[model samples]
Target: MTRPGVSAFSVLGVCALIGLAGCFGPPAPAPTGTAAPTSTASPTASATSTASPTAPSSPSVAPTATATVPPPSSAPADPTPTGEPTFTGFPEQVARLTVYYVAIGDNGVSGPMIGCGDSLVATSTAPVRFTDQVGPSIGALLANKSRDVGLSGLVNALYQSDLTYLGGELAGSTITIYLSGQFMLGGVCDVPRAKAQLEYTAMAASGATSAEVFVNGRPIDEVLSLK
Candidate 1:
């Protein structure tokens, strides 16, 4: 009996089936003078990402260059000094002797006397000593004038008959003669005659214009008035 009875659940199932049929059925015809509704989809929102800020980079620097220095040089100094050279020797290297003689003659107004007669009697060349004394060769000849063969009437005016020549020198235009002993004369007339003889003889021998006579280191003018 229970099984044959119609259940409420079965009846409700049939109603639901009918409703579903109405919902799933083909679309109704559009109404006259009206358009159909269009399907509309919902709008969606999209996500956005943000970027961070970075610091600026620094600029690069270049390196500097350096220079090198050189070392000093070394050498020896000069040895020679700067000046004029010195020399030592005699002023004249070679020397010779020449003898002058006087001849005895008669003056136009006076008696016999000795003079050069304005000319030389003879010339002799002999080597002289390097010493301060007069050359011995010339001194000997002058002291011994009597030995000369050609000097017959001629007299040695400078010869004192006892005196010997010590030295002689030519200074400027004068010839100086040094004697070992004193000079002797006979009279006043012998003054000018002796002076003339000496001057002429010295001039001829040494090529001088004047003569200075010295006896025993004393000037002849001190003792005699030769003026």
Candidate 2:
């Protein structure tokens, strides 16, 4: 009966260790409340582009126009007629006549003198005969005693002495007085004195420069020296 030494207690200990390992095998399942660390790549950030603000433009300008001015006009000249006679301070109907007188000094020395007077002679538009106008003017000078200055009608004395003043003519600057004959005077001194009175009086009246005496239409050579 004791022949075999097989131990019943040892066999029973090994069976007990196998049963304990089976019961604790595999890691315990993770807890549901704590999730596993997921490696989902984080969504890459999208790159957004931004634009800057722009400035406003200015308006264009136009050019201006200029004005022009005109020049002023000049005045006209005065128009006066020529060749008309001008008289100052005298009436239209009046004319100035120049007559002669004798200059007297101590001791009977005598010479010719000039005097101007106003005479109211008849003036007409028609041509007047010189004898009709000038003869009366000399007569008026001789008859007027108030205007007489030692002049005693020398022209009238020639007329009384038979020296007739036939009608005269004025040609250029010389005046010709015609007589009937060659009349002799009292003396040689009388010739020049008488010629001086007549020549000056005639020139002053008729505006002539020289005088010529004629006897019977013939020119006389020796009459008087007009100094």
TM-score (all chains, Cα) for each model = 0.40, 0.35
Q: What's the lDDT for residue 178 in model 1?
A: 76
- Top-TM-score candidate index: 1
lDDT of 1 by residue, 104-147 (tens): 34442232234322222444545664433234433644565353
Which 10 residues in a row give candidate 1 its minimum summed lDDT? Answer: 41-50
Candidate lDDT (C-alpha), each: 0.55, 0.47
* Maximum-lDDT candidate: 1
Off by over 4 Å in 1: 1-97, 106-138, 145-152, 158-160, 224-227
Candidate 2 lDDT, tens digit per residue, 1-227? 66877598878889999999999899888797876444333323221212333444864655544334444446435646669677443222334455554332212333333222111112112232333344433444333334233334223223223455565666888776665644444444445444555565556555679877665676544533321
Deviation in Å, model 1, residue 16 alpha carbon: 50
TM-score of 1: 0.40
